[model samples]
Target: MVGSFSDIGATSTDFCNFRRDLLAYISGADAQMVVEDMYKNKEMEPDFYFDFDLNEDRELCRFFWADTISRKNYVCFGDVMSFDATYSTNRYKLIFVPFTGVDNHKQSITFGAGLIAREDVESYEWLLKNFKTAMGYTPRCVITDQDPALKVAIPNIMPETRHRFCMWHIMEKVGDKVGNALAQNMEFRKALNNAVWDETLSVTTFELKWAKVMQEYNLVQHRWFDQMYKARASWIPAYFQDIFMGGLLKTTSRSESENSYFGKFTNHHNSLVEFIMQYNRAIGEQRYHQKQLDAKGESSFPETKTPLAIERQAAAMYTKNIFYDFQEEIWEGNFTCKITCKTNDDGGYKYTVHETGGNIFENEGVEEIPGCYIVPRWTKSACAQPMYNVVWKACSNTQGGNELRTIANQLWNEFYNCMGLANGCPTEMDIMLSTMQELKGRLQSARQQTRASTTPQSVIESILNATAPAEIQIKPPSVAKNKGSGKRLKSNKEKATEKGKKKVRTCATCDRPGHDSRNCPERKALPDE
Candidate 1:
């Protein structure tokens, strides 16, 4: 493209420089709204909330923000959040903390984000408080790694919130904290995995299995083992079976998933402004993927495996990805499930489903899905539920009445119906495409006519009043202290196995043989190993 510019009577450097510094200026009192005036535009509480603190020298110190869409997402999926702080996402080494949750699509959705100059209790407290303020309520549950600062801050900030450690984070450390021989032993790994992940077992049974595994592996006296056992209530499913998010994320941690998802658009060398721009891109991509899944759920349906009426109902109710899982359960229940007990209840007859080598379930009815309890959130209709729409309407600026809203919704419905017609009548696609093109041209022509009808003085006023960008006085933050944690500490064997070589690991600070860090070290120290 730069080379082609020469043919168009421009040099490469000229094109590049012009493109780099290009700006559009708007100015004057008429065009600009004061912060106070904007705040007064809404009578209700603001849909967005952002807060930042400055140091004694008036430089950026800590910041947190959540937008309208994110806050709306919180209203729907805010029952659970997976949070962890990451570093090296900006040049000043600010810790990037993202509060992420799972949506109806079973995909990660960000609730809010923060960039803190420090990773201490004070900084985290400020960040969480801002998040709570933005979303209007605390999440019912939160999953996080065992961060020291968060351990102190979250409970103090939101005592009612159910806090738990990520099981995957704990499981990842097994090989690191334990010796290589035990870690490599398939029998030991299996025993430990079964002990931690088997929710079917009772709390006492889980404890017994854990004790047997620890005893067999000679890890009972290990410091790491002891700490894990002490915190079993936080991560172990046997202890928190009633938590709505326990099964969704306890076994497979989304903290790491959120980290990787946001990590794609950020880097250690990014400036504050650069980081914000890229962060927006990351969020746009995240929401775009969710939209694609939503479209797929609406337009497609998977074929049922069995001829069961329940399967057909399930296929209609669930999204494609979750339907596969439901299908597997329905298929397996045919063989593995047996009715062990049936008892009468006020509402209906309650029967106990005894599955082979799994947790027993007390469900209503025998085979009909309508009579049984279903998780509405996992269904295709989850996104369309009127409850969430109420939240959106409350926050929205469009203060239209029910009739106007219905008409607006009908426009979209008709648009989708057209798409369906196009799909159903594939042979007429060429005509349909031509009709759409003609409609687009007509709309553009109408828009141009309306713009041309505007008074020339109005356009002249805008051009005359436009001004250059306002100067910002705030300075960037100094490099600050971060938690310097988050990633699992990989053992020598694990690292070698992953990289396919026995490389010499070294102390990052001293460069004495052992670690690579994305977040650079503040000071030199010996390797913990």
Candidate 2:
């Protein structure tokens, strides 16, 4: 029953109370003896034995002891270093997390320190120094956000080691700045994505292509590109290129994925120590899973597949031919034809053609002609040309002359009009004259009908004539003056009172009624308290 209390609901507080009660029960001289007996009995219990050493083989024992003893001593020997910083909720925190790369399967965190000021150079240097002390040696590589502080501090502290920017952090920044439009423009997006794999092209070429992509999507130029370019040499892990870094010299998405795991435990915990413990436990579980995965021979990760090479090959083959075909369609016409071919310096061919006396009246390349142009019968006959015209003459009713030619000419003109081209059709003036003559005949018929239907009547004589131009009548000067004087008096009154008077406050000092605060010297004096 006494041991059951320790087993069932044991806590530090509970254990402290238990210790006090046991001490009081045993009393003064027997307390130490009773404690030793209790400890030895608890140690002998199978449950306690199993809890401490259940899977403790000689190898496991050696590893456990070595890790335990070395970690304390190794506190001064830095081995694994991680440089990570985050800015959220308007506060910046950097963490130099130290770990021991004990086995391929395990990394034991030796020590970690949180930095309040990420941007300060001294703060980052302090973190690196702490990391160096926590692990057994200087870190081989420091992974961090692409922070300027880390760039400076990492090199200064561990000059021989590598510094890497986190790929996930950069991508997040790209999303925030460039936005979904980068994804919307598929070609530009592919170009940007492909930039990582383009080793044949120099970094400068990649940068230029990147700029072109940003321009295509109308994204503002960002500092991230400069950061990426600067960190290209070190951040790309040589051995882990394809396996971990996606074959690019950029940060991995692992940090972000880890951060997300941490986010789940963030609720209602105000203690930093609690947060760290929970985070470490989570990390342990993740390591366990990763170890299982590794045991299954699946530790190596696959690189992201970039289709840039295939796309470039396809584009190179098709682009020029497609452009030529489009231009040929625009130039298609029928005529007496002349074709000219020229060879470019690059071994490519350019073709030009001129077509005369046909509906299709231009030249085209061999590639440009439509399938209809190759019809055997149409090719043989000159009249079958796209723009062929037939001449026609007017024929009397008694004898129809050249009716076929007239029909052909009308059809040709109609086709020309449909094509929005002037191929020698009659002018608008001719159309207008013919329309007016037809209208004149209709007008004459209407006039004859009106004449037949109506009768006119007139008066016989006028008895008296009216006189011309009566003498000019004008108002007397006195009446005009009286009329004008009334308006003048009103105008004079309006002029005298143009705008209403503004109320003016009297100045206290000057004792003048028209002035306000600006002219009041009394207002400028200091008031007595």
Candidate 3:
């Protein structure tokens, strides 16, 4: 094309410039049309949304896209979100931001996306505002890489949401702060990981262990450790474990996974139009895979390793993926741990659990390691509270508490029947419906019995025996009278039938055969006729 243009009397310098302009026009026109089509069909595609900002030259700068399915997934599983704005792909240099979560099948789900011209705080705030508006609610927690501008903007916009820095992202940078010699130290890495991943540790315990490690490594003044210790609440699991996160996310791993998955669809050489096209294709495939998982989970139940009621209950209660997690916990709780002591505390029972084999929390230089997992169990009410917590209640202290204790003991027995401590004995709408059905059944049965008793065979037989056939009588045909004199005329068929048929003589007064009322012997003779 450039050579052809040069043959048409264009200068040598204009050759490269014309080629650039042609490519720009091609990519820009397609990009603009993509956004325009999304807007044009917004009414028909109620969930489809796209917004774009233009520079002074009316060129596309920022764009946001979210379909209806993304909005609904956010509503269902958006309790915890991982928003990443780090990936800069395509020729336009736009940063890709995806709102991601985990569905019930433990699959990565994209909630929404944004593309920005810049990575400044203002761009991030705009993206977050639009995402919140599209999703209709703020997530309970948001996890992201440690971006200084995002840290400032999040508290301003999502003040109520817990903003946490991703543990994996921070851990990946540990080698940069710690010397290479210390980075390769297996013991050092193990201790640091324990401090980061152990949610059961108390704040004081974590601080002590962290201090001991720093002292042992002779890095008390390390700037990275100093900053991390100061901002520990945002990254530490011990601080926010009690908060409801819906098991959706803990780090930016979901976002990284999404990027890796989407990488196949796009690259630096692609145009904006190609990027959008590949994005749709990627999202469609992701959803298709999730649907396949959903179908598999619905059709097949997870296999149980034990006959425990709680295991069965979990399989019944949770999705297939979640049930496996629950099953693993049940297996771990029974196999690797045991109840050390049970004590009464504040109208509830506290059970101390101790790990038996391969303790996870054995520190160096300590003679005996702490293996107890402390879990506080409290009874809030009489109603059977269904809570999804790691803590298990052995008994409650309340009115009729023994019954509750018996039930708990039964559950514990079933849970640990492999080890066997002791084996012992053992809605309102449903009630109303059962009662109504019972009454209806009884009423129908009574009506059937009454009909059977009232219509006996003897009464039916007597009525049939007494019934008699009725007698038939033929009447004489009447004649039409003449106008002047009382003369009569009759049809020939009627007159002949009347003459041929024998008439039974019956008196009108007595209604008896063989006697008219005027000549009856039983009647007194009239004196003067």
Two-way lDDT contest, 2 vs 3, winner: 3
Best-first order by lDDT: 1, 3, 2
Better by TM-score, candidate 2 or 1: 1
Clashes per prediction?
Answer: 3, 15, 0
Candidate 1 structure quality by residue, lDDT tens digits, 358-389: 87998888455763477766777765552244
Worst 10 residues of 3 by lDDT: 374-383
lDDT of 3 at 20: 55
Candidate 3 clashes between residue pairs 3 or more apart in a chain or in different chains = none
Clashing pairs in 1: 505-514, 506-514, 507-514
Per residue, candidate 2 scores C-alpha lDDT tens digits across 201-309 of: 6656666776776576655456665666565565433323422221123454334444445556543311222233454466557556644634433333322123334
| lDDT digits (tens) for residues 408-460 of candidate 3 | 99977864762343233215445545766799789879977886776333333
Model 1, stretches more than 4 Å misplaced?
1-45, 337-367, 370-372, 383-473, 483-529
lDDT at residue 37 of model 3 (Cα atoms): 49
| Local error of candidate 1 at residue 240 (angstroms) | 1.5
Which of candidates 1 and 3 reaches a greater TM-score?
Answer: 1
Candidate models: Cα lDDT each: 0.74, 0.41, 0.67
- What's the TM for model 2? 0.33
Whole-structure CA lDDT of model 1: 0.74
